[model samples]
Target: MTGPRFTALAQSLPATVPFVGPEAQERAAHRPFAARLGANENGFGPSPKAIAAMAAAAGEAWKYGDPENHDLRAALAAEHGCRPENIIVGEGIDGLLGYLVRLTVEPGDRVVTSEGAYPTFNFHVAGYGGTLVKVPYRGDHEDPEALLAKAAEVAPKLLYIANPDNPMGSHHPGAAMAEMVARVPEGTLLILDEAYVELAPAGTAAPVDPDDPRVIRMRTFSKAHGLAGARVGYAIGAAPLIAAFDKVRNHFGMSRISQAGALAALGDKTWAAYMHRLVAASRDSLAEIARANGLTALPSATNFVAIDCGADGAFARRVLTELTAAGIFVRMPGVAPLDRCIRVSCGPEAELAAFAAALPGALARARQG
Candidate 1:
């Protein structure tokens, strides 16, 4: 019997998984990590309120989640001072990214992003047969001007920028981001991914009219909110831009319990503030850990710090391998200069202690070989 044939685009694509998850790694290693700090997930865990809400709603999991996502959207709209029409909730920012790429990209269409920015976005763009035009980072930060220039040059269908960017954890001021937004070409759409916004310092997130049609800003409960496993995220944009998501998005994609949990999480601002403090403290502690090991941790506004291993990508990879072998789970950037650094996420004392204990040995082992 003959096997099924893939579409032309699928046949043309390489079989690549953008991220190798921790579960897969554990399966291969035959052991659990002593410290799991990679992937920028908030290790402090979710609020008591959110946990309680989810537990209460778990019994009703047999029913499909609300297709409209009405209750959660309304609560989110009220929190952000926008109409429900301005919001589109999804499984997570990753899923929302896929939907956005599908909505705007045609086969061979152009998309622009930072060279070493979020790989998930790039993966989705590639899946849709969009040509990715990448701009290298300037000074370890996503250069807004360069990105804008490339967008204009390519007249890309979509441009992706992650404020408080991942892997590096650097960010531009809100005013600077607004300036870039103003300069975006008329036909292009900007995807401002603010997954780490809750951890950013004040004024780091640019102020924009939530109704702005030129860009859609995505926020997730994954990072600062400690709800990564819930897979809840939302996009804010002009009503029309947000409404378009409904045309192709999986209406019943959101888990009902996740909605309840996220709503409770949003309402408990005090708990959010507490986690913010914990993250800030963990960041400092991780920085100190890096410094103690003679490594330099880059200044960060997110839950992760990019520590310079004072060498090239190969050396950094060696350090990462040793660390992982020592049961410390962390990640590094994928591109050249940035890849010289290893990224570590902020977590509770116990996890940080494990990383701290493992670092010197990891460095020593890497240096020996």
Candidate 2:
């Protein structure tokens, strides 16, 4: 029998994934991690109301989810002061990114993004045969000027920036982002990943008009609302651009339980505030732990902190290895300079305490090596 034919692009791609979950590590080691602090998940968890809603929705599992995502889109539009036509709710930001890439990128189309930023976006771009032009970050931040310059040079079909950036936990001010938006080249469509904005300080979200065709802002319940597993996310853009998603997206991909949970979560402002405070405290705790270890914890506006390992990428990797060995799950950046730090997700005091206890031993062993 003959094997099914694979496309040239599929054959050319490497057999690799962006991340390895902590569960995989636990299974490999035959032991569970003492603390789960990687993956940038909101360990503070979803709202109680959301939990109840999901429980209630469990009984309706037989029915397919609303393909249009009407109610959720309407709620999101009201929150953003835009019409429902301006929003597109999808499985999550990751899934929405894939759809966006499929719609805009033909084979060999150019795309621009920060080097060592979110790998998932790069994965989607590559899957669709887009050529990526990556620019290195300036210090710990994604340089808007650098990205803009490259776009002007390459005239890429897609451009991506993540505010309150991952792995480094650095952010550009909303005004700075607004300035960047104004300078986006004529044809390039900007993808602003705002997964962590709900946890960031006020004035951190760019004041972009929802009807602006040049950019699309992506938000997720995965971070602030602690609904990562639920896989609910939405995008805001001009009505026409938003409508384009209908062509390529998975219509019934969203789950009924997830939709109900997200709806309940959105209405729970009190729970959202509580998670914000909890995450802030957790960030402070992580900073203190890093300080005690003679490391520097970079200022963060998201639900994680990047603790510089006082050396190069190798040293940070050693530290991460030691932590994992000690059952404290954590992650680090994959590239140079930026990889000099380990990323830890914010969690309750108990989990953070486990991390604090393991850190000194991890540091000592890493230094010895």
Candidate 3:
């Protein structure tokens, strides 16, 4: 019997998972983690109103979701002061990123991104056979000037940057981002991932003309709204670019329950504020824990902190391993200099205490090794 034929790109790619989930780790270890802080998930959870909405929509789960995402889009547009045509909602930022890469990249097309930025975007680029030209991070932040220089040199189809960057939790001011936007070379589209913007300080989001074709900004309910599992994300850009998603997107991809939950979550301003306060407090606590343990917690505007381990990537890896062995789940960066620290997500006091209790032993054992 003959097998199904595979495309050249499919054959060329290696099987990989960009991030190994906490659940998979639990199964392998044959025990549940005492603290879940590795995945950057909001332990506070979705708004109560969102929970109610999802419960209300559960019976309607059999029905297919609206392909147009009309109500959600309208609500989002109202919130952003833009028309519905300027927004497109999808399964999540990851899915939207794939669609964007598919829309713009052809085989051998050039793409520019930081060396240790979001790896999933790089995964998508590889899947589509795009050639990625990566620049190193400037300190803990993505270097806007260096990225623009590379984009100008190669005229890449896509330039990717994550504000309040992940794995490091550093951010640039919105004005700086606006300046970067102005300098984007002609013929290149910028992919601005703002998944953490809701948790960041005021004025952290750049001002972009809704009709400007130079950039498309991706936002999600995953971080601040505590809807990570619900998987609802949206992109804002020029109407034409937004409309182009209709050409290749999954018409009914978003879950009906997820849509209901996200829509409700978006409207709960009080809940969002409470979460912001909770995350800020927990972040401070994490920093204090790091300080007590003789580590330096990087200043962060997001819901997580990167605690420098006072050594190289190997030592940080050992610390992480010891922490995981002690049942405190945490993660670190995958590349050097950046990887010299471990990333911990903000959570409730109980979970933070668990992390605090375990960190000292983890560090001591790592030091002994």
Lowest summed lDDT across 10 adjacent residues in model 2 is found at: 172-181
Tens digits of per-residue lDDT for model 2 on 1-369?
999899999998889998999999999889999999999998889999999999999999999989998899889989999999999999899999999999999789999999999999999999999999999999999889999999999999999999978878999898888888899999999999999999999999999998989999999999999999999999999999999999989999999999999999999999999998999999999999999999999999999999999999999999999999999899999898899999999998888999999999999999998
Runs of candidate 2 exceeding 4 Å displacement: none
**How accurate locally, in lDDT, is each candidate?**
0.92, 0.94, 0.95
TM-score, one value per model: 0.99, 0.99, 0.99
Per-residue alpha-carbon lDDT of candidate 3 for residues 1-369, written as tens digits (9 for 90 to 100): 999899999999989978999999899999999999998899999999999999999999999999999999999999999999999999899999999999999899999999889989999999999999999999999999999999999999999999979989999898888888899999999999999998999989988887889999999999999999999999999999999999999999989999999999999999999999999998999999999999999999899999999999999999999999999999999999899999999998889999999999999999999
- Residues 1-369 of candidate 1 have per-residue lDDT tens digits of 988998999998889989999888888899999999988888899999999999999999998999888988899899888899999999999999999999999898999999999999999999999999999999899999999999989999999899989889999998888888899999999899999988999988778888988989999999888999999999999999898998999988999999989989999999989998999999999999999999999999999999999999999999999998888899999999999999999998999999999999999988887
Clashing pairs in 2: none
lDDT of 3 at 167: 82
Off by over 4 Å in 3: none
Model 2 scores a C-alpha lDDT of 0.94
Candidate 1 residue 291 Cα shift, in angstroms, is 0.7
Q: Given candidate 3, what's the lDDT at residue 65?
A: 91
Clash pairs, model 1 backbone = 174-206
